[model samples]
Target: MPSSSASPPPPPWLQPPFLLPGFKPELEPKIEPMNCPSGQLEPFVTRDTLLFTPPNPNTVPDEVENAFPEHLRLAHHLGASSNDHRSVISAPVVEVPAGPSDIVGSRKRKARSAEMVRASIVDTPDRLYFRGLVRRTRMTYDSLRYLLLTDDHGRGEAGLSDEITRRRKARSDLTAGALMGNRDLWLNRDSRIIGCIPGIRVGDVFFYRMELVVIGLHGLIQAGIDFVTAGRSTSGEPIATSIVVSGGYEDDDDKGAVLIYTGQGGRERNVAQQRSDQKLHGGNLALERSMNYGIEIRVIRGIKCNKSPSGMVYFYDGLYKITDCWMDLGKSGFKVYKYKLLRIKDQDEMGSEMFKLANELKQNPSGGRSVGHICLDISTGKENVPVSLFNDVDNDKDPLCFEYIAHSIFPQQTSQGAGSMGNGCDCTMNCSMGCYCALKNGGCFPYDENGTLLRGKPLIYECGTGCKCPLTCPNRVSQKGISYELEVFRSIETGWGVRSFDVIRAGTFVCEFSGITVTKQEAEQLSDDGCLVYPGKFPARWIEWGDISDASPDYVPAGFPSTPDLSFSIDVSRARNVGCYLSHCRSPNVFAQFVLFDHMPYPRVMIFAMENIPPLRELSIDYGVGDGYA
Candidate 1:
C-alpha cells in the first residue's frame, strides 16, 4: 500500500534499472492501422488483424508450388474462425501452363550452345600456347563466344553457309564432279573422311616439301605443311610441263611457290655467321622465288601396306595444292610464313603412285648415300665412302679410282694409223708448235686464267703420257678429277646429280665423263636391257679421216644391227663415277667436248659449261635426243 503514488514513478530518465538504467523492453507492441472517418488511425485492435490475406499458391510455378504442400494443406484442417476460413477461401487461384514459346526459348538456348561448339571446332588453335587466343589480338575466346552465341555469329554463319553453297556449286561445275568426288585416293578402311580437307581434322601423313630434302621432314611436318620437294622426271629431265610439283625435287624444279621456305637457308648451311643472319630475313625471298617461278606443289597423304621389318605401315595422305601463302606473326610473336593449300582432284592417283614408288625404293631408301662410291661433299673436303658395302666381285670394280690415260692426240697423223698414239710433248713451258701434240692443235686445256673456258672449239688433243712435260703442264686438264667444288646428291626425279654451292661461269670444266670402257656392241646389249650408257667420242684418226655427224649413232660391230653411228661408248650400269650423274636437258648448260690426252684408242669426253650456271645448278648435257627421252 505504501507509496500509493508509486513514489511518483521515477522520472523517465532516472527510473529503476528497467526504466532508468539504460535498458529497454525486449518486446514492443507494433502499431496497427485502422480506418477512421479521417482516413487514418493509430494503434487499434481489429478482427481483420487476426485474418490477414494470404498469397495465392497458384501464382507460383508447379515446381515451386509443389515444394510447399504443407502450406497449402493447412487450409483443409485449419482450426481458425469461420471468418478467417472465409477470408482464405476468398483468395483467387490462377494456374498458368508453359506454352510453345517456353519450349522454343529452351531450344534456342540449346542451338546457341551447339553453334558455339561448332565455332570452337573451326577456330581451334592447332597447338596451344597461352590458351584461348591466337598469336595476335586479332581474335579472342570472349569475342568468339559473343559472336557465336548470339545472332551476330549467326549472321556470319549465314554468310558462310552461302559461301558453302557457292563452293558446292563450283565443285559441281568441275569435270563430271568426279575430281573432288572421289575419296578413295586417300581414304582407307582405318580412317573416316571429313570436310573438304580429309586430314585437317585428323592427323594424316603428308608429303612435306622443303628446300633441303634431308631437313624438310622436320620443318614442314612440324609446321603442318604437307609437301615434299619435287625432283625432275625419272629421265633427269626438268619438269616444265606442270606448275605443280608432284613429288620430291624434280629436275629444275626450283621455281615458284616451290622454292618458298620458312627459313633463310637449308640444312647444309655450316657457316655460323650466315645462319645467324638468316634468322631475321623473312620468307619474303622464298615467297618471291615461288611467285616468280610460277611453281605449284603437290602434297600427298594416304594409307598403304608397308613391307618393312615394322610390318604394314600407312604411307602419306592425299594431295594438296599450295594455293596461297603469306607471312604472319607466329605463336611466339615471331614472323612465320603461312600457306593455304587446296586438295587436288587427282589425290588418289598421286597417293597410289607415291605408294608404289615408295614400295620400290624401300629397299635402299637412302639412295646412294651409302652405296657406289664415296659421296664427296663439296662444302666440306671429306671423302665419305661406304666401305662396308664394297665387295671383291670384280677386280676392276674400283668405283672411286680410275686411270687417266695420257697419250698424244694429233689432228693429222701421217705415220700413225687411226687412233695411233703420238709422241710426248717436250714443252718446257706452255705447249708451243715445237711440241708434237701442240703442232696439230692448240693446247688441250680449255680453261682461261679465270678457270672458265675461253671459247668453244672442236676436239683439242692434249699432250698425253708421251709428253715429257710435268703433270702441271698447262696442256693437262681433263686428267685431273673434278676441279671445282662438287656435290653428288640424290634427286627425287633423277637418281643422282652433281651440284655446286657457288656459281660456275661458262666454259668451266665441270668433270670428266668416265665409266667402264665398253665396245659399241656391249653398250647396245646393255641399253636393250634398260641400262645407262653414253657414247664416247670418236678416235682422233676417225675424226680426221671420216665425216662424223652429231646425229649419227656410234659405229656398231658388223654382227650387231646398225645402231647410232657412235665411234665407241661407255657403259656405267655397274661401275661408274660422278659423270654418270650428269643429267640431260634440251637447253643444257654444259656440253661434251672430245679431248685426247693419253694413247687410249678412244677420245676422252670432257664436260664444259656452255652458259653461266648459277649456284646449285645441275649440270646437264644434250644427249642429241628429243625431250621425251633423256
Candidate 2:
C-alpha cells in the first residue's frame, strides 16, 4: 500500500512528475478578472467557449503560449484515469458604417419614377403650357416638365386662360378700327390704289390705303387741278362729301382751264383746273434782194460802124454816137462794151454818107477801097467834060497796103503780109520775069515729074508748038476779063481783078480750099489750136490761079512726100498760111472739120456753116482743123 498504489496518476491539471525524482512542474499563472458591473468575479472567457477553467499544463503547447491570453485558456480533469480537457481558440470579427451618397441615390431613383407617372397623366392643355414654358425659357423639354410638375399646381390653369383672352381682345380691336378708316384714306390720295375692296380687316388695310390717298392728293395739287371737283369716282364713294371742303378762284384768261364735277348723291358742283395747251404760224425775202439795185441789161443788134483817123465812128442814126475808140474784150468773142455821146437830131445827117458806105461794104466783100475804082467828073470852061482820074496803077506792087485797107473796112477780115504766100503775094519770086511768066514757067507747073501740062500751065500743043495765041495759051490765061461796058484789069502777081460787080454778099461763102497740112507739133503749139481761129491774116485778094512760089511758101505737100511724081494741086496758102492767119476767139462764127484727102496733109480744112452774122463782120475759121501751117 504505498499510498494507494501509485498516486493515481497525479492529478490531470498538474504536470506528470518528471520521470526522475526531484523534478518540479512549471505552470502559467492565472490572470485576474476584469471589474464587473455587479461586482461579481467574472471568469475569463474566450470566443471559443462561454466557460472559465484552469489552464492544462500539458495541453498548452510551448510555441503558442505567448500568443494566447492567459485568461482565455482553460484546462479540466475527468476521473482518476487523469484525462484532460482544453478550451477552443479563435480571432475576433469587425463591420464598417453606411455612407451619405448611397442614401441620396436611392431617394433620387424613387423621385424620377414618381415624375414619369405624373407626366403620363398630364392633359393637352397642361402639355401646351409646358411646351410654351420650354420655348420661353429656352430650356429642354425634360427641364420644363420638371418645373411644371414641381410648381404650385393650381396656378398653371389660371395663367393659360388669361393669355388666350388677352390675344383675342387685341386682334378684335385692330380689325374694327381698320375697316372703318379704309375708304376715307384711299379716296384722298392720287396714286392708283389696289386691293382696297370689301371683306378686309380694318387695321390690316388702313395703313396702305392712307399712304396711297395722300400721294394722290399731292399730285393733283401740283398739276393745278382741283381734286375736290375732279369728276373721276373712287371706291364708289364721293371723296368731297367724305372730307373737308375749301373754295378757290380760277383765272378767266387761262385757255387751258376746264370745269369738272365731283361728289355723290346728286349734290356735286363744278371746279376749274388748268391743262396742257396743244396749236403753229410762213412769208418774199429772195425777190426783194434781187431788185434792190438799179443795174439793167439790154441786148441790141444791127449796129454799123467805121474806122476813121480819129477813132471808130458810128455810121448809123442811133441814140448813141461814137465819141471814143473801140476795144476787144480779150479773146471773148463779144467785143468790149462801148460808151458813146448822145447825138443831137441835127447831127444825124452827117452819118448818112458813112452809113451808105457801111451798107455797101457789107453787101460786097470787094466793094471797099482795095477792089473798087473811083473817079470825079469836072466841067472845064463851059463845055461839060469828064476828067479822067485813072492811070495805069500797079496795085499788086503794094499788096500789103491794099490788104490793110480791106481789113480796116471790116475788122473781122484779116490780111497777109508781103512775103506770105497766101493770096498770091510772094516777095521771094524773081521780079525780072513778068509775074505771069514766073507763075507759069518757074513754079506753077502742075507738080508733075515729066512736066506734063495741068490746070495753071500754058496749053502749048493746042496752039501749035511755035504758034501761040495769047488768049489760048495757059501762061497768058487769066481768071479775069474785060466786059463791053468797062475795062477789067487783071493782076498776075496777086491774082485779083477790078470788076464792077461785087464779089461777095454779107455772110456769103468766099474762096475755099480743102487741103490744109500741119505738123503734129505745130498743131499742138497754138493757144486755142483745138478750139477757135479768128482771122488774123487773110489775103486781100482771092487768087484764082498761081504758082507755088507766088502763093505762100509755107505750103506743105498734101500726102506723104515719099509718093513720087504726085500731081495734086491746091492753094498752098489754104494748106499752110490761111489757118495760121486766123486768131483765136473763144466765141467764133466759123467752125472747122478735117477733110481727108490723098495729099501731103491728110486732114484739110472744111469750114462749117454758122448762125449769127452782122454787117461787115469778119469771117473766122476754127484752128482745130490744123495748126494753120500747111
Candidate 3:
C-alpha cells in the first residue's frame, strides 16, 4: 500500500450514487465553522446537540468557567477540535481486560447474528444479476445522475420508486442524509452499515433526493430488471393468468376437458364473481373476452404443490375451446361463472395419431375394400366371419319410396309451392338455394359439418323425389344410405350386430331400419318370431291388440268406430337390412327417432349416434324395452 498519510479516495461506483442530480445542496444542513489552534476546519456533524468531554477521565473542568462556544459542538463531535488534540497527548489512561468467557460469548453472538442477517437476504438469480450491475458498472457522476434521479419521483430505468416509499414508511429515524452517507449498497444486511448510504443527520432535505437514488438502485439490485415483466405461453401467445379455477366441472373428461371457476365477488376478488362481472367489473373482462373469442388462457393450478413451473412460470396445459358458460352458487354463497372448456389436440400430436390410425385401417384383414354391398372386417380378428353378409333388400320395395312419399301425402304442396317445414327450406330437386333437408334439420347431415347432432331434437325430413333436388342434395343424409364403413358380426351376448370401421362422432346418422310396410296388428302377430320391429310403440301396450294401430279399413274393433291412431310397424324379418342386426343395449351408442315427412301412413325409424364411437365398437339401439321386457 502507498503511504498512509493520504486516505484512499472512495470507490468510483460509490461516488456516482451520492452525486446524482436530484439531490439539492441547499437542503443539507450547514456544518458551522469553529476556531481551532491548528486552523479553522469545517467537518460533517450529527444533528444531536450532546456535549463532548475530553479524553482524560481524571481532569474535571467547571462547566460555567470552561464551556466551549455553541459553534464548536460539531467540531467536538467529529473529535477534530484543537483542544482534543492536546488532551489526547497529556491524558493518562488505564486499560481494562475482558474475562475469557466474556470475549468468547461476544464473539459467538456476533457470528450468530451475522448468520441470521445473511439468511434473510433475498439471493435469487435475478437479484444477483442486478447487484452485479451496481458493483461492476462504472460511470461518471453526472452520467449516473440522469440514470438514477432524472425525475424527482425516482422513476428510473429500474422502476423502483415503490421500494423507497416502503423503506421510508418502515423506519422513522431513516433520513435522506443518512441514506446518502452510506457507500456500500451492494452488501447484504450482515454488513456493519446495512444500507448503501449511512451516517447523516435526520431531516436533511438534500440527502432526501439522494435517498431516492439509493432506493432506486437497491430495488434494481434486489428484484432484478425483469420483475415487472409479464409472462407468456410456450406458443409465444401473450397469456392472461390472473383468473383461477378450483373445483372440477360436471362434464369434465380426463384427456382434454377444463372447467374454470371464476372466484367469488362483493369484496375484491382475484377473479370475476358473476358472469356479468366479466364485462362490467375488474380486469376480468380481458380474460372473459379472450376465452370468448377462442384465445387460450394460461391456467395456473390453485394448489401450491401443483403450481410447479412447466415452462416460463406455470404449466401450459393446452389451448381450450370455451364450449359453455353458466352461473351457480359459489362457496361464498355469491354467484360465480363456471366456464366449460374442451381441450384441443396439438397439431403435431393429432397428425401423428391420424397417420397411425390410417395405417392400421389400410392393413385391415378384409383388405380395406367393400365386399359386394358390405364393408367387411373392420375388426381383423374380432369377427367370427372373414367378411360381413346380408340378404339384399330390393331397392324398389322400400315402403318410404323416395319417388312417391311426397306426392302421396302433400298432393297440392308441390316443390314450386311454399315447400318449407320445420327449419327446412323449400328447395326443389336441383336445390340451387341450398338443400332444404339439411337446413331444416339443424344441419345434422352426416356428410357435412362433421355430423354433430343437437341431442333430443324432433324428427328430420329429407327431400323426396317430388322435389327437383338431385340425388346429391345435402339433405339426403339417411336417404343416401349408410355412408359409415360398417361390418356385420355375431355378438357373444346379443346374436348378430353391426360395428363401424372408423371412429364416428356423436350425432352422425348411422342407418335406417328399412323393410316391408305392415299394420300394427300384423307386427303383433309376428312379434313372437322375433322378426317384426316396432320403432316407437310404447312397451306397456305393445302386446295389447286394443292399443295396436287398426288403420286397415277391414280391421275395425267391435267398440271403436272412428279411425284408430296412426302407428304402423315394419316387417323386416324376411327382407333384412343392415340395421336388423343391430343389438339392443341399455346404454346404447345409437338412438332411433320416428321421422314422418311425406304422408306414408307409418313413421320411418332413423338412427343416430348418441355419443362418439370408436373404430370396431359394436352399435346398439334402445329397443324401447320397459320393465316387462327386462
lDDT scores in order: 0.31, 0.21, 0.33
Superposed Cα deviation of residue 93, candidate 3 (Å): 78
**Predicted candidate 2 versus true structure: per-residue lDDT over 31-124, tens digit per residue:** 2111122333333222233121224432221112111222112111111111111001111111111122211111100000000000131454
TM match of model 3 to true structure: 0.32
- A best-first ranking of the candidates according to their TM-score comes to 1, 3, 2
lDDT of 1 by residue, 256-316 (tens): 2233323322212111122111221212222222332333333322222222111222222
Pitting candidate 1 against candidate 3, the one with the higher lDDT is 3
Q: In candidate 2, which residue ranges exceed 4 Å CA deviation?
A: 1-355, 358-580, 596-601, 621-630
Instruction: List CA RMSD, all candidates.
Output: 36.8, 74.4, 34.9
TM-scores vs. true structure, each candidate = 0.32, 0.18, 0.32
